[model samples]
Every structure is written in structure tokens, then in C-alpha cells.
Target: MSLSRNILLWMSENRWMKERIPKFGFVKKAVKKFMPGETEAAALDAAYQFSLAGIPSVFTKLGENITQISEAYAVRDHYLRLIDKVANRKLDIEISLKLTQLGFDLSEEETFKNFTAIVSKAKEKLGNTVFIDMESSAYTQRTIDFYKRVKKEHDNAGICLQAYLLRTDQDILDLVEFNPAIRIVKGAYKEPGDIVFKRKILVDDNFFLCARDLMKNRSNKNVRAVFATHDEKLIKRIREETERNGIQKSKYEFQMLYGIKTSLQKQIAKEGYRFRVLIAYGESWYPWYMRRLAERPANIWFVLKNLF
Candidate 1:
């Protein structure tokens, strides 16, 4: 990564920055360019608009690593209500969330309980997939293990995997048996060079490899794969591979973040490719916002523009 990106990613992990940066008015203004607002209502309204254009959305309330078990239960109940909200609105929306937000740190058993309840409600109400958002390297194995356990009971469950990690190639292979619903993205965490691909080209290459592996299993009806990225070159490469493999356009999906590439997302959908946009909301956005800037240092200009 470039030095600017490296610094921004470092800032994303710094507790001091996390505590103070969100206090800046200009920073908050810049954050609005990514997230519509900190409330789920704002997120849902934006998604409802997208649905009018025939675009489906994934909703996630951002906050992770909660300190209390009661807080986790509240988070769980929040999603249960969110699912009901979607069903009531008849919107093309699904739910994605961090396991840590549901108390992965407090108790794995309780976390599983919380996750299953949310997934069960989604299954009963919307009949859609409930995605488990992957976190840092520290929780990688445990998250994968938890996802495996969840799959035993819920088929409408999916997991995100980071292509930047060296182990992801094998990780994808191991889950092939589950005919897993995997959303592969170039990771956003500031991980060490030993475990992750530090260079952009290497990460991009790994992402393509992961995409190809998932698309290769298109013949399986249960293999629901999503490529969650904004890299146009990599997206084209995946498209070419998909065509060459004779995989139908509906066999896999492409997901991008809200407000990042609106035109490209529309183009992807217009061209008959399945697409979804992830819209995140909630108070715990400082770290998430920093990581968004870290992904593309060029976005610093947007932050700077907010100074006026």
C-alpha cells in the first residue's frame, strides 16, 4: 500500500484517533459522503430509493466488540426488528452484521445464540440470506468456525472472506463442501505483512483467484457467491472468466458499497448481472470511515473539501 493509505489505516486502528476524530465537524461532513446517516432509518430510506431502480441492498448497523452481554442482546433485538422492518416495507433488502457486535468476545455460545435468532427471524420473515461480516485477522479462525456451525442449521447464511489474507485461498477450498455463500472482498484491516498481502497488486491477484474458484462451482445450485469490490479491472477479469467458464450471469452476484460507484453499480445491473449494495449505519463509524479512506487515499480530497 502507499504511505498515505498506510497512515490512514494506522489511524483507523488508533484508539486516540477513534476517540477524537469523529468529534471534528469537517470529518463528520466527509463521512456523510459514504454513509447516508448514523441511523438505520436513513439507511433504509436510501435503500428504498435504490429498490425503485431494481437494485437490492444489504443493511448493516455498524458497531463491534461490545463490552456488555446486555448490549449484545440489544443489538440482536435491533436486527430482529430491522428484519421486520424490511418485511413490512416489502423492500429488496437483506441483513449483514459483525459477529463481535453480537458478543463474540463475551461468549461464543451466547454469540451463536444471538446470531441464530437473528438469522431465524430473517429466514422466517424475508426468506433471505443473513451475512456474517468478517473482522480482523485475530478473529478470522473463530469467525470461520462459527460460520461453519451456523450453516449446519441455516442454509440462508453467508460469510465474508478477505482475499488479502494468505490463508483465504485454502479457507475457500475448505468450505467448498458446504457449498457456501461466500462474499469475497479485498480486506480493509491494517494487518501485518506476514499474514496478509501488503501490496495492492498481490491482493488484487488473490481476489481474482478467489473469484474464479467460487465461479467455477457455478453448477452447484447451493453455491451463492458475491464479489464485493470496486476494482473495475478485477471486475472485468472476473466477468471474462465467468463467460469463458459458461457460467450464467445469475449464477453469481457483484456487491459494492453504497455511494462509492453508483454508475458502475447501475451498469452492472443494467448489463444483466446480479448486484447488491451494502449500506451501513450506526454510531460506531469512526474506525469504519477511516478504513474507507484507507482503501483509496484519493478520497482524502473529499475530506479536505469538507473544511470549508
Candidate 2:
């Protein structure tokens, strides 16, 4: 990675930086450019707007790594209420979550129990789905294991895979047997060279490889692939590959973050492809915001423009 990108990612994990950065008006304003606001109501309002635009959404509250079971339960309960709201309003949206936020740090069993509760509630009440967002490499295996256990009972549950990781191709192969639903991302966390691809080209190549495999497996009714990226070139490439391979547009969807690439998202949706926006909200957004900047350093110019 570039030096500036490394600095932004390092800052993303710095407790001191996270604690203080949001205090600045400029920083908070820049964050708003990415997220609608820091509340469940705001998130739903954003989702409502997306629905109006004929776009679906995925909601994820901004926080992770809870040290207490009560905290984890609180997170689960919050999502439960969100699910209720989605069902009550008949909204076209889904929920995504981090295992750590559900007490993975406390105990894997406890996390699974908490995760299962939310997924079960979503399935029963909303007839909707929930996705487990993959975190740093440290939790990759554990997250997949948790997904496998819950997915055996609830097919509405899905998990994310990081294309930047060296093990992802094999992971995709292993997961195909279950005919799982997966969201493929280019990964955000700064990982060691041995376990992750250091160059963007390598990461992009792996992303397409994994995506191609997922497309080939689309004949399995249970297989769903979500390409969660903002790279138009990669999206075009995937589109061409899928078209050439006789894959239907409905077989997989393209996902992008809310407030980023709205035009491209609209274009994709207009072209009759499945498109979903990830709308994140909550007070704990500093780290998430920083990672977003790291993902595209050119966004720093956006932040500067917001500041000025």
C-alpha cells in the first residue's frame, strides 16, 4: 500500500485518534457525507430514500468488539428492533453485523447464541436476511464457522469474504458445497504481507477469480453472490464475464456504500442489474469512516472540500 494509505489505516485503529477526531466539526461533517446520521431513525430514513430511488439497502450499525455480554445483548436487541421496523414498514432492506459486536471477544459460543437470536428474529418476523460482515483476518475462520452453524438451520443468513486474503479462493471452493450466500469485498484492514495481497492489482485479480467461481456455481438455487465494491472497471469486467458465461443478472448483485458513487449505483440499477447500498449509521463511526478514506485516498479531497 502507499504511505498515505498506510497512515490512514493506522489511524483507523488508533484508540486515541478515534476518541478525539470526531470532536472536530469538519471531521463530523465529512463523516456525514458517508453516513446519513448517527441513529437508527436516520438509517431507516436513508433506506427509505434509497427505496424511493428503486435501490435496496443493507443496514449495519457502526460498532464492534464488545467486551461485555450485556453490550452484546444490547446490540442484538437493537437489531431486533430494527428488523421489526423493516417488517412493519415493509422496507426493501437487510441487516449486516460484525461478530465482535455480538460478543465474539467475550466468547465464541456467546457470540453465536447472540447472532442466532438476531438471525432467527429477522427470519421469523421480517422474512428478511442478515449478513455477517467479515472483520480482520484474526476472526475470519471463526466468523465462517459461526455462519456455517447458523446457516445449517437458517439459509437467510450469509457471510462476507475478503478477496485480499490469500486463503479466499480456497475458502470459496470450500463454501461452494453449502451453496452459501456471500458478499465479496476487497478488504479494508491493514494485514501482514504473508496473509494478504499487498498490491491492488493482486487483490483485484483475486476478487474477479472468486467472483467468477461464484457465478459458475449460480445454478445452485441457494448460492447468492454480492459483489460489494465501488470499482466500475471491476464491475464491468464481472458483468462481461457473467454475460459471456450465460449467468443471469439476477444471479448476483452489485453492492456499494451509501453516499458514495450514487450515480454509478443508479446507472447499474437502471441497467436492470441487482444493486444494493450499504447504509451504515451510529455514533461509533470514526473508525469506519477512516477505513473508508483508506480504501480510497482520493476521498481525502472530498473531506477537504467538505471542510472548506
Candidate 3:
């Protein structure tokens, strides 16, 4: 990563920075360029608009590492109502969330219960899919374990995997038995060199390798894959590999963050490939926005231009 990106990512996890940064008007203005708004209503409206444009959306209300059971239940309830909202509006949308946000930090059992409640409700009430977003490397094993246990009961659920992690290759192979639905991402966390690829090229290479594995395994019919990236070269490689393998475009999708690459998203959707945008909204957006900047350091220029 570039020096500026490294700084921004470090700041992203700084407790003091995260608590104080979003209080500035300039910061909030920059955030609006990424998220529609910090309310469920705004997020739902954005998804509706995307549906009209022939693109599906995935919504995640941002906040994580809850310390209280009540707080975790509140998060679950919010998603439960979100599922109902999607069902009532008949919107083509899925939901994504962090396990920690559901109470993993407080109690693994409580987190599992909360996660099951939300996903079960989504599956039973609306036939909607739920994606478990991967966090930092510390929680990787536990997250996968929880996902495996959950997958045994609900086939509609999926988990996100970070390509930047050194263990992701083995992780994918291990998950082959489940024929998992995975969203592959070039991880954004500021991780140690020991456990993650420190160079962008290595990360890109691993991403393509993982993509190839997923595409080649599509014959299983249960390996639903989503490539969550904005890198054109990597996207092209995955597209070519999928075509070379004769994998149907319907079996996997390309996902982009909302507002980051509107034109590219439209182009992908226009080509008849499955395309979805992750639309994140909520008051707890500072860390997420900083991570977005770390994902593409050049975007800081865009924010600066808009701000000044």
C-alpha cells in the first residue's frame, strides 16, 4: 500500500480518530459521496433506484463489536425489519452484516443466536440471502467456523473471504465440501505482514487464483461466488477465466461499493452479467469510509476536490 493509504488505514482503526473525525462538516460531506444517507429509508430508496436500473443491491447497516446483548438484539431487529421492508416493496436486494456487530465480542453463543435469528427470518419470511462480512484476521477462524455451523441449516447464507490473507487459498479449498457461496474481496484491513500479503500484486494474484477456483468448481451448482472488487484488470481476468471454463454468468456476480464506480457497474450489468452494489448506511461510517479510501488511495483526491 502507498504511504498515504497506510496512514489513512491506521487512522481508520484509531479509536480517537474514529470517534472525532465524522464530527466535521467536511468529513460528513465526503461521506455522502459514498453512502446515500445514514438512515434505512435512504438505503432502501437507493436499492429501489438500483433495481429500476437493472442492478441488484446488498444493504449493510454499519456498526460492529457490540458489548451488550440488548444492542445486539437491536441490530438483529433492525435487519429483521429490513427484510420485511424489502419484501413489502418487492425489491431485489440482499443483506450483509458483521458477526461482531451481532454480538460476537460479547458472547459467541449469543452472536450465533442473533445471527441465526436474522438470517432465519430473512430466509423464512422473504427468501432473502444474508452475507456475513469478514473482518480483521483475528476473527477469521471463528467466523468461518460459525459460518460452517450456520450453513448446515441454511443454504441461503454466504460468507465473505479476503484474498489478501495468506490462508485464503487453503480456506477456499477447505470450503469446497460445502460448495460455499462466497464473496471474494481484496481485504482492506491494515494487517501484519506475517498473515497477509503486503504487496498489491500478490493480493491480486491470490484474488485471481481464488476466482479461478470458484469458477472451475461452479459445476457443483452450490458454489455461488461474488467478486467484490473495483480493479479492472482483476475483473477482466476473472471474466475471461469464467468464460474459458464455460461458467454461466448467472452463477456468479460482480460487486462494487455504491458510488465508487457507477459507470463500471452499469457496463457490467449491461453486459448481462450478474452485478450488485453494496450500499452501506449508518451513523458509524467513519471507519468504513477510511477503509474505502485505503482500498483506493486515489479516491482521497476525489474527496478533496469535492470538499474544496
Candidate 4:
């Protein structure tokens, strides 16, 4: 890892740093280049701006692992409000939800109800897509099951898959039987080697292989693939492999995290590929922000330079 990235990860682990840095007005200002703000409005506005610029987005409210049913219910309400606001404007946007935010740790039943409520409301409001994000490996089976139940009722729903996981290929094959849109990410969390492949090359290879399977399968034509990564080589390989395999550009899209690789986002879009920005918003950005820093490493220096 780069020196700057190392510093950021170190900072992420430093509880004092995560807690105190936001207190400094300048620190918040510096981080705004990436975080946008600590509110739903801030996230919506940023996503709207991207939409205007021809870059579609998936708005993810920044929080995770709710330990209380009340907290999950409240998070569901926040999404309901967001849906209402966007529907009034007739905006074209989708929502990405994390199951952990639905009190998965507290009660599986409660989590299912909370997630289903959000999807039902979203579908009612805008008739747009609702994507359930995959959390850590522990919740993988539950998430898949929850998605299965929800998708049975709402065809517009989808879920994410982590390519780094050992079971991802089989998971994709099995889930494709449901015909849901799948976002393939290299994963963000630091998981155990038993559950996830450790090397970047292995992870990238898994990502492409899974992507290829999803693209080539005939029954999975409805299986819109989201290639969520910033690696240029992987992007090129995707482009070449997709063309070589006769998978039309419209069948899949490239996804990137917001505040990183804007140029690549534009470049891919300009080159005739669909691009979607994963725009995150909320007060609970420390962990997510740390993961982003770990991914780019250079962002650590960027944030530090801004502080100075």
C-alpha cells in the first residue's frame, strides 16, 4: 500500500481520530470533497448533479449494522422520505440498501420486514430499481434469502455479490435462477482468508469470471451486471471480453465509488458504456470512508494536504 493510504487506514483504526477529526470545521470541509455532507439532502443533491451530467447514480445512505429494531425502522423512514422527495421531482435514480442497516444483528425477521418495507415504498413511489447491498460474509446467506423473498414480490429489486468470496461463483449461478440484477464488487471489508481470496489478482480474476458467466447466460438477460471497480486494466479487459463474447454494452454497466476516478467514469461513459456512481451519504461515513481510502491510498495524502 502507498504511504498515504497506510496513514488513512491507521487513522481509521484510531478511534480518537475518527471521533475528533469531524469536530474540526476544516476537517469536515476537507472531507467534503469526498463525503458530500452528513445529510440526505446533501446526498440527493450530489446524485441529482450526476444525473444532470449524464452519470446515473445509486444513492446509499451511509450507515451499517443496526443493533436496534427502532434504528432499522428509522432508517427505513429516511429512505421513504427520500423516495417521496425524488418521486415528486420525477427523478431517475435508484437506491442501494445495506441489510445490516435493517437490524440484521438484532433480528432476522425484523431485518426482513424493514428491507421489504423500503423496497415496497420505493417501488410504489418511483417504480425505480431497489438494490440490496451485500455486507460481510456472515450475512451472505441471510441477505440472499431475504432478497429471494423480496424479489418474489417485487421484480424490480436486486442484490450485490462480492467477487472475493469463495462461494461467489456458485452464488451467482444459483441467484441467477431468480433473474435479479447483480452488482459485482471486489468487496470493501477486511474479511477472513477462509471466506475471501486474499490477493488482488485472484479477486480481480474472480470478478471477471463471474461477470462473464452472468453476461453469457441466456436466461440471465435480465441480469444487468454492475462492474464496480476503478482498475483501468480490468475495465479494458471487460470491454474487450464483452465485445469478444458478443455481450452488448447495454446489458451491463460500470460502477465506481463517488469522489474517486471521475475521469475514468467520464471516459467509460464517453466510450459508449453505461456508468453509475455509487454515491454514499450520512453521518456514519468513517468506516466507509476508511475503506475508500484503503482502496486508493493516495486519498490519504489528499485529505492530509487539505487539512494543512
Q: State the C-alpha lDDT per candidate.
A: 0.92, 0.90, 0.89, 0.81
Per-residue lDDT tens digits for candidate 1, residues 1-308, read: 78898899899889898899999999998999888999989999999889888899999898888999999999999999998889999998989999999999999999999999999999999999999999999999999999999999999899999999999989988887886899999998888889998778999999999889877764664789899999999999999998998788998899999989899999999999999999999989988899999988989999999987
Residue-pair clashes, model 4 = 0
Q: After superposition, how far is residue 144 of candidate 3 from its true place, in Å?
A: 0.4
Q: Looking at model 2, which ten-residue stretch has the lowest summed lDDT?
A: 213-222
Higher-TM-score candidate among 1 and 4?
1
TM-score of 2: 0.97
Against the true structure, what is every candidate's RMSD?
1.1, 1.1, 1.2, 2.3
TM-score to true structure, per model: 0.98, 0.97, 0.97, 0.91
**Candidate 1: stretches off by over 4 Å:** none
N/CA/C clash count, model 3: 0
lDDT of 3 at 153: 90
Note the residue pairs that clash in candidate 1.
none
lDDT of 2 at 56: 86
For model 2, residues 68-101, the per-residue Cα lDDT tens digits are 7899989989998888889889998889999999
Backbone clashes in candidate 2 total: 0
Model 3 ranges with Cα > 4 A deviation: none
Those runs of model 2 whose alpha carbons end farther than 4 Å from true positions after fitting are: none
**Candidate 3's residue-wise lDDT over 44-122, tens digit each?**
8999899998998999999977778899899999998888888889988899999989989889998888888888988
